[model samples]
Target: MKKLFSFLLLAFMVVNLAHAQQDPQALKILNQMSQKYKSMNAFKATFTQTLENPSAKVKETMQGDILVSGPKYRLAVSGQEIINDGKLMWTYLKDVNEVTITENDAEAESMSPSKIFDMYKKGYKYALAGTEKQGAETVDVIELAPEDRSNPIFKVRLYISQKDKTLKSWQMFRNNGNRYTYSINNFVANPTLASDTFSFNKAKYKGVSVVDLR
Candidate 1:
């Protein structure tokens, strides 16, 4: 479930990298998408994640939601809730009524929700794979491959709406044959957020066990 959260939270947004080798068309679209998110104060969205492993004949789908504001975010999925308020992080398990706390490591932000919008700013090559009809919208398909071959996630594909330049969905291909697809079901740009939205309030979770790993 932690692995799933890593990729699920990354579906939020990404900024562009100035790579000369990147396809011009893809870079243009990426820059536009980045600008769209950079202009927002905060955003909230609901998504559906489908995990599939053909070899194991395993397939599962779940619904999730996320709220992001700068370096803070709150994500809920698969019976778990992860809250990061820039300086710290809390992971709560619903079934066990336990919450683990840890200091937010800045170094890992590139792969975490805080820096998801800049994940593609380095160590990746991207290109526009063309466009296709995704339900009612025509989406531009962009494919990205990590320059470092050893990365667990080998490739990623993003679908952005051609009409509004918003991300519709993304797919992550792992080296271990696990494929995860996240589709944005609903999106709200620049929603007003409460100050405590990103903080973990233990009081709300009655009888929740606290495990401080910081």
Candidate 2:
């Protein structure tokens, strides 16, 4: 009887230990930060995207407020507006005064990677990319490679904050040999939002026609 009890206890402990090792250290931290990224049903923040190619560097500085829910999102820059009400993605270029709408796909590929709350859960594999100290903070570097390498996005490296266990910045490598890097600064969390904010407003832009790209 004593021997049987000891064997069962050992088996239980072994199973728990195995489960603990399932997720890599970096992946575990990323998931925790994802909670903050996932908490707000809708939020608004300023976004700046800079694309660098070998020959030339294109920098686009656009400040926008974003409202996101489930798979739907609506983004409106200072003088521009974009809507994706789950079924269609609408982009209004204020400079050109053109509205482009694209049908939402099952894969949701139209959405940018930074919009992702859970990248690893979407079939991304992560590996440790060593640690580095920046000023007074220690940052953990992690590299994520996609299982399906079909698109221009080949791999991504995330520089995560060690103290807060949050992502600081990420660099995405493209197949064309050009890398895209994005750093999110001054992220604010706003949980209190209206449901209608994510919906499309056709009347607001009376003259703009929805250019269908489906």
Instruction: Name the lDDT of candidate 2.
Output: 0.64
Tens digit per residue, CA lDDT, model 1, 1-214 = 9877865654422223213378989888888887777888989999999999977899999999999888889999999999999899999999999999999988666566445445666888888878999998999998787777677887788898889888898898887889999899999999988868998888899999999998
Clashing residue pairs in candidate 1 are 15-117
Total clashes in model 2, counting residue pairs 3 or more apart in sequence or in different chains = 0
Q: Compared with the true structure, what per-residue lDDT tens digits does model 2 show for residues 1-214?
A: 9868985885564334323433478667777767766776555555554456653454444444555666666766667777777777677887766788787665755335335657766656676668987566788887666666474575677777888765666777666646666565555566575656655566776676667788
Top TM-score hit: 1
Q: What are the C-alpha RMSDs, in order, of all predicted structures?
A: 7.4, 12.5
State the weakest 10-residue window (summed lDDT) of model 1: 11-20
lDDT of 2 at 98: 75
Candidate 2 segments exceeding 4 Å error: 1-23, 55-65, 76-80, 108-115, 133-137
Which clashing pairs does model 2 show? Answer: none
